[model samples]
Structures are given as C-alpha cells and as structure tokens.
Target: MLATRLTALLGIRHPIVQGGMSWASSNAELALAVSEAGGLGVIAAGPMYPDDLRAAIARVRAGTRQPFAVNVPLYNKRAAEFLDIVLETGVPVIIASQGGPKAHIGRFKEAGVTWIQVTANPLHARKAEDAGVDAVIAVGGEAGGHPGPDEVGTLVLVRATVNAVTVPVIGAGGIADGAGIAAMLALGASGAQLGTRFLLTPESGLHAAYKDLVLNAGIGDTAIVGRGRSPIRMVKNAFSAEYEAAANRGADDAELDALFARSSLRQAAKDGDVAQGKVEAGQSAGLIDKLEPAGELVERLAREAEAALSGAASCIR
Candidate 1:
C-alpha cells in the first residue's frame, strides 16, 4: 500500500476517504467498516439534531477504535450544534463544508480536533487555509449532491487548489476506481474522497433501488438541478425533471424550497422513491457496476492504486 500526507495526517492506513453523504451516511455501519478497512470514514452530521449526531458518534465508537470523521455542512441550520456535539464527543476529525468555516475553525482547533475544510475552488481553498483549517478537500462540480455553482472538474480543480493553498488538498468528484485515486495524487492531491462509490457499498444503509439506479446508470444519467442555489447532482428522474423545469421558468426561492421539502434526498436514499425523491449520485457511478462490502472495496482500491502508481513509475525507468 502507498502512504501519503493524508494517511499520516488523518491517522488512516489508506489515503481514501468515504464522503459524508447526508441521509445516506447517517448510519454508522459504513463509516465503521471503512475505518476498519484502514480508510477514513466520515459520518454525515448535516441535517441531524444534536442528539441524533451524538448517537451516530456513539455508534461509530462502538463499532471501531480507528479514526473517523464527521462532516458538518455549514448550510445546515444545526451546524453549530453539530460542531458542539463533535467537540463534546471528542471526534478526532471534523470536515467543514458548504459555507465559510471562519466561525468554527478556531473552536475546533482549540478543542484539538483535526479540522478539514471542503472547498470547491482555489479561492475557497485560500480562505480555508486562512481560517486555519488542518486540510482542504477540493470538491469539483462533477461531484454528487451539492457541488456549488463553480463548474470546474476534479482534475483541474484539484491541481489549481493544490497550487493555491499550502495545506494538503484532498481531491473529490468523479473519482471511483484505483486509477482515479492515482491520477489525483499525480495531480497533487494527498488523497481522494469518494461519495458515489461508497454510497454503492453493501454496508451503506441506502435503499436497494437507489443502489441499483447508480449501478445501472451511465455518466450522462445524472444531471445538476437547482440553478438559483447550490446545484445538486442527481439522477434524471421525474422529480428532478420537474424541479429543473420549474427553476428554469423563474421559480422563486420559496417555490424551490417547497419542492426540495417534498422530494428531499432523505426520501430517495432511504425510501427508494426515485420518481419523487432526489437520487444524488456523482458521475463516478458509471465506474461502479456492483455492490460489495466496504472493507473489500477499500482493499481493492488500495491494491488498484498501488499497481497503477507502480506502472506510472515504471515509465521513468
């Protein structure tokens, strides 16, 4: 296996990280499995109450002694409370995303929790470093769920952010297999964070229908909706089509919010309501054809990345 700054910094055996996909990642089973497999498993702390967050943390701790993280999307109104939960529970790592981390970085640092901020562009990376974040996760537009308005892909965004910031940059978006991991490292990312791939893992608590949609879908199957706000990448279902059409026709913020409330990601991931619920998935969904155990997938990715790196190095000789 290959080691990088990310593995050393996060105290994980591999440089792979399972993204904290809200609703889908609320269950600690997948996180625990990934951590046990030597990769960092981050629990989704977004859209959860303080008590629920506490319970999720407890579940992870009960499952594994290895290091893990909790992703706090600042867009969540309960973000501050979630941070408090992380601090109170002594979570080893906290990933701040979806908004500025200026307010919470200091507190996280003071509590000795490793703070990794998620950025979608070079400016965000610089700002995160200024906020004193321990690391930066550069999420590109191709990523599933909310990837911000910027349309930069993972390859370009990762390289640019790595050049712009002094902190270690983790590449996200469109990454799935071992080759993708190796490619990102070559572009200067310390590691890769995968959202779609892990969502398809057997340990993930997402519904079977959602996993089937992802497995059968191609790269063109997913589309980005919600133009007025942070666009979310989701499968092209009836709900997505209606939402996109309404947004294109000048739907107000209130209308959009209503639509979101009616067809939230939680419904899609948990209830398997593909026609009405938001099926969030990255373009990497095309790369994955089957659902396997998280531990098996992690080991497979490590082996693939190691072989890919070895092959690339052979060219120099």
Candidate 2:
C-alpha cells in the first residue's frame, strides 16, 4: 500500500529501488529476491559482456515474474551492446546512468521499455525529461562509485531536480533506512534508490570482508577521491590513501588512470582485497550494521517508511 508515482509507473508495490552495483549486481539472486518482495531490483549491466548480460537477465526472469530493471552505465564502451541484449531479452525497464540518456532514450521508448535516467544535478534532470525519460534518479555526492562534480547533498538535490523536471524523481545517495525514504518523499521524490544499503544484504555477491568493512565504518569514514577524473566515494584504506595523495599532488589524468587501472573493483568485491582494491560505497555505510535477506530487508523498509510517515502525519492531528 506504499504506492507512489514510481511504484505506479514501475508496477511495484513499494517505492524502493536497489542500486546497480558493478560486480555486486552481476548475479540475479538479489535482484530476483527484491523484485519478488515488491521493490524494483536492478541488474548492473556495465561490467558484463553481451553474453553475460543476456544470461544474467535470463536468470532473473526465470527466477521471478515480477518487474525488474537493467542499469546500463551510458559511458561504458559496450553500453549499446548491453542495451541491445536487454531489449532482445525483453526486459521491462532500463535505468541509464553516468552519461546523457538522450541518444538511447528514444530507442528504449520505442521498445516499450520504461526508461529512467540517473542525474547528479538539475541540468541533467531537465535534459533527461527533454529526452523523453519516464523518470529521473537524482544522485548526490554521497553516492558510491562515480558521483557528479557538483557535490550536492541528497536532500537538496532531490528537491531541485523535482522542480526542474516533470518526470518522477527518485532520490539516491546516503539513504539507508525508512527515515531516509520518508525524508526523500517529503522532498518530492517519488522513490528512493539505495546502493550502499543493498550491498550488505545477505543475497549480495560482495565478499564478507568487504561487507565487514562497510559494517564497521562510520558516517565520515567514506572519502571522495580523484575529483579531476571521476569522484568516487569509498571506504578509506591504504589504496585510497595512495590514490588520494597522488591526486592531491596534481597527478594527471593519465596518472590517475594508471593508478586506478592497477586494480579492478571486482578484485575487492569478489576477492575481498581490502587493502589494494577499491571498495566503492556511499556515506550510507554508516547506517548498515547487519546482513539480512533482500526480501526481508525490502519488506522492512516499506513497513518502517509507512510507520514513520504515519507518525509524522499524526503530529498535526
């Protein structure tokens, strides 16, 4: 009964959407479980080849009949290929991030797919609406992976984007609980998308050590590095320290690329290389303390958000 514009448009019961993490979202179990729990689960199609993406989509479809989405980082070299595979596989929704959706939005609309664009600012939000996107996910600097250069907070970004676009807005970054979802809704967001919160779920494919790091981290433990290149929020470690130091000393883009190229995100997410590889997470890591099933977490989030909203409404009465 926690229906919103997002839930109505996506045909889901709850307005919660799990983020598309690179290595973590490659598998279908988490996505399937979340979708079955009445929230939209997104499979990250960035780190996968065409064949792998197709297989992942098939696995989720076979596991659950509920609606799910495929997130394609528009900047990825194989993004178009992944989109083709998703369309061919008959996926119902598409979430595009990290680049402009103008070129691909038309194709997704033509395929009768629900196209959602991820934006870091109002400018991008307006652009997405102009491109015919059904919705826009406003991501703030508190987000994991590559955040936008504006470095705006989620609360303010959500409201600004909502005013700039006619499409439904989903707030993302630093949101880990029912309180956060309620706050976003109050800010005019129709839904909330959480990457860091979902990363620690039991169904997530992330390594136990990485999850432990996330669980142990505090609110300010995350640091944004490589501003000139791609601003990324991750748990502080020896690897990040070195990377940050290099960037601070005026490292060129090539140098930054070389530094980052030394290790892959999968190395940390799958193999648990806490010291060397990057553990991309958001400021929301501070809110996660335990691991639970994706389905249970989804249900809990919905119930908690409902109760919180009801309590707030009772204050006026």
Candidate 3:
C-alpha cells in the first residue's frame, strides 16, 4: 500500500492521478477505468459545454463508485458556469488551472469541494497555496498542451514547489510508469499525475492514428511548438511545421488566425489527421507502447512502482 497524503485524502489505493487532457482524456470510459483501478481520474472539463460536462460526470459516476476530479480551466470565459454545473453534479473534487481570482477558491471552499491548482513554476504554486488550495500540481515543460519555458524539468519543478508550499504537491510532465511515480514520491511529491500515458490507453477516445503516434514515438520525437503565443508540445507534423513557420515569420493576428483556422484540433483528435491537425501530447509518448485497458494500466503501474521501490531498498542493504 503506497500510502501518501494524496492517496489518503482521495481514498485511492495508488498515489497516481491521471492528468486531464483537453479532448482526449475527458472521455467517460477512460475516467471510470482509472478510478476503478485505484487511481484518481480527472475529467477534462475545458473543451466541453456545461451540459456535456454534466453528462460526462454522470457517465463516470455511473461507471465507477470511486472518486474522481473535474478539471476546469480558470481562464475560460464560461468557467463560472462550468463550476456551477460541477457543483450541481455534487462532484467532490475540482482542479483549477490557468489562474483565477482568490474569491473563486473561497467559493469552492464554501461549497465543501476539494480544490487543486496546477502550476508550471514555484511562483504559481505559492500563489495557489495562498489562495487556499488543498494541493498544487506542478507541470514542467515536458508536459503536453501549454507548457511553460523549457528551462525547468519535472524533477526540479516538483522539488521547488514542494519546498515553496505547505500543501501537497502533485508532480506532472513526462511521467508514464511506476518508476516515474516512485521518483516523484522520492522527490517529496505526494502523488504523480499522467496525461500522455493515458492517451494511449485503449479506454481513451483519441483516434487510432493519434494513439499509434504515441505508441511509436521515440525519445525527443515530441517538440514544443508556438513557444511565444501558445507553447504546446506535440508530435511533429506538417501542420505543426506550418504553424511554427508562420509564428516565426511574425504573422499578424489575421494571418495567424487564418493559419490556425486552417487546422482543427478536434477534427484531428476525432478524425485522425496526423498531417493537418493539432495533436497535443507530452514527451512521455516515448514510454507508451500499446493501448491497454485503463484499469490494467493503473494496476500495472502500481505493481511496477512497488517492485522498483523494493529493488531500491534491497540495493541499499
């Protein structure tokens, strides 16, 4: 039993949490499977409307009796509405990202909901702590979607955040296996969060082509694109190249809009267009080899972490 503050707080058997992915990780089947496997599953609430989010939450609850979290981007215009829907659904945990007012944190506290905030640096972690968050998730540049500057890796970021805040730290970015989870715990994190690993799981709703890319990608195959405007890590392709070139050439707002308009993120995720769509994934893609059930993935990670920790102990003696 890998007990930690997070495991005890969330009532999970493992100290691993699934990172929320905008379009891919929000699916009900994957979320339920992760929870059933004894890890916390987070439903990505950013890309869905209020009704859709409620429905997804219902679906997850219907599938698993275990607790789960809903990730809401604080920067979204509809964040308040989404929060209301989440509260209405009686979801126990809500993860807020992208910075929100302190009053929002207080609101969640008043509602008796556990609030977690994601930070890319220690400064954000400190801010989240000050805002009364129950925990902070520190994501490094190796993460997918919008990562901060590439100067800090997950190890450094997690350690720094742990030092800066009294709240529990959930380490993210480039973590896929039990070895990674063990390392995070050793580094003072209460838990580990993963996104890329779950994207390749059979329960994920991502297109087969996208899943294949994750399974086949090697180390360094994932690149950070649009560093200045919308820094995102993804598999390199013609669409990414075009977007990067346009950003480099100083394309104006209209030009950039046209360039971005040509590519569709949802279409790519749903239709499997490797060449013309935006596929957000982390550098951890190299570690994923196959699409298995989410429950199997979670169970295997726990066993692997236990074995790794035991091996380390034996070596020390």
Candidate 4:
C-alpha cells in the first residue's frame, strides 16, 4: 500500500482519496465501498438536504468504522446546516471548499474533527493552512465541479500550492489512474484525489445515461463555460454549444447568467437530461472507458501506483 503523509494523517492504508463529487458521491454507497477498500471515501454534501445528509452519514458510519469524510461546499445555502449534521453525527473528517475556512473551521477544530480544505490555487491553500486545516487539496481547472477559475492545470498548480503551503497537499484534476497517482506523489503531493474516475464506478450515484456520456467522451469532448464568473467543466453537448454560441456573439452577463442558471447538474444526474442539464465532469472523463466496482478500483489503483513508483526507481539503477 502507498503510505504517505495523507495516509498517516487520516490513518488510511492508501493515499488515494475519492473526490466528493455531487450527484456522483451524494449517497453512502460509493464512500462506503472506497473506505472498506482501505482508501479514504467521501460523501458529497453539496446537493443533499439536511435529513438526507444525516442519513447518509449514519449509513457510512454503520457500514464501516474506517475514517470517512463529508465534503461540504461552504458556498451552498445549507452549508451551515450540513456542518451541524456532520458534527452532530460525529463524522471524523470534514472536507470544506468554496469559501474561506476562517470562521466555521474553528468550530470543527474545537470538536477535534480533522479538517481538509479544497483549494483551487496556492494562495487559498496557504490561507486554509493558516486557518488550521490539517491538509489541503489543490484542484486545478482540469477537474470538474468548480475547479480553479484561474485555469491552471494540475501540474503547475499542485507544485505551486505545495511550495506555497507546508501542509500535506492532495493533488487533484485530470487524474484518472495509478499513473496519475504516481505523478502526483512524484510532484510532492502526499496524495491524489480523483473525481471523474470515481464517477465511472458502479457504486457512484450517477444516472445510467450520465455515466454513458462520460464513458464515450474523448479528451477534447469536455469544455469550460462561464469564464470570470463561475466556470464549470463538463461534457460537450447542446447546452454547452448554446452557451458557446451566445458568448461568441458577445452576450451580456445578465443573459449569460440566466442561461447558466437555467440548467442544473441535477437535471442531468437525476432526470437524464444530458443535452441541456449541466453534466458536470472533469477532462479525465476521456480516460474512463467502463464502469468498475469502486472497491476493486481502489485496490487496483494502489497496486498499480506501487508498481509504477517501483518502475520509476528501478530505471535509475
């Protein structure tokens, strides 16, 4: 197994962390499977109601005593309630994002909860570390579901964030397999978090159509919409095409914002409205070809990473 700072900090066997992708990871199934496989699994709290969040947390706890996390995007209106549920349920780890960790992180810290902040840039990583987070996940624009707006890729962003902060950095974005994991560890990241790769797992909560689209998507099949506002990377489809055409014609903020708000990830995830609903996914979708069992994928990834690292070292001798 891969042992690094992330593994030691979280007491997990591998340094691989499942990305708390909304819709994909909203349920307890994916998180439970990964954790049972000796990797850190995370329940995404973004699209869940308070009751559902509480229920999911209970399910994960009931499923495994292993350390699992709940990702709560602070920008959501129910973030406060989600945090309350996380604390009330005694969830061991909290992965926070989309807002500064100064205020509420203190409360979680007081309760002896391990805090991991998701940052898009080096500056945010530094701020989160200073705010007392145990570690930080630096996700670049190549990731899905609100990657860095600055459009930095994982290579430069993770290295820069590592230099900018002393805390263990978990590199994310455009990572799909064991090779990606080895690359992150080589670049000084203690661990690697995978979003899109995990989405292809059978345990993920994605709709059948949603998974199919991502499976067939190529490297260039994804696009980034809404620059300078709230950029999202997703599969190319009718909705993205319309947005691009509007932007090309110089649409104003009001028009673009309305268009953006009209679509939702839930539409695609829940209702199978892939053409119009925001099918949020990372560019790594191109790398995914089939659905694998989450538990098996984690174990396989760890072995492959170990082999890859060994191969790299052997080449030197």
Best-fitting candidate, scored by lDDT = 4
What's the lDDT of the predicted structure labeled candidate 4?
0.93
Could you give candidate 2's per-residue lDDT for residues 156-212 as a string of tens digits?
899999999988999999999998999899998999998999998888888998889
Per-model C-alpha lDDT, please? 0.89, 0.89, 0.85, 0.93
> Candidate 2 or 3, higher lDDT?
2
lDDT by residue (1-317, candidate 3, tens digit) is 79999988788899989888877876677788999889999898888878888888999998888989999988888888988887889888898888653868777788888998888899878988887889989998788878876548898999999999998899999899999999899899999999999888888878888888768888688777666456678888888888878878888878776776777667678899978887788888888777878899999999988988888788884
Model 1 scores what on Cα lDDT?
Answer: 0.89
Give the better candidate number (1 or 3) by lDDT: 1
Name model 4 segments beyond 4 Å from true: none
Q: Judging by TM-score against the true structure, name the best candidate.
A: 4
- Pull out the clashing pairs in model 2: none
**Candidate 1 residue-wise lDDT, 178-251, digit = tens:** 99999999998899999999999887878898888888989889999776565789988999888878888888
RMSD values for the candidates in order, in angstroms, are 1.7, 1.4, 1.8, 0.8
The candidate 3 region of ten consecutive residues with least summed lDDT is 223-232
Q: Sorted on TM-score, highest at the top, how do the candidates line up? A: 4, 2, 1, 3
Q: Is candidate 2 or candidate 4 better by TM-score?
A: 4
Query: How many pairs of residues in model 1 come into backbone collision?
Result: 0
* Candidates arranged by lDDT, highest first: 4, 2, 1, 3
Q: On a 0 to 100 scale, what is the lDDT of residue 248 in model 1?
A: 84
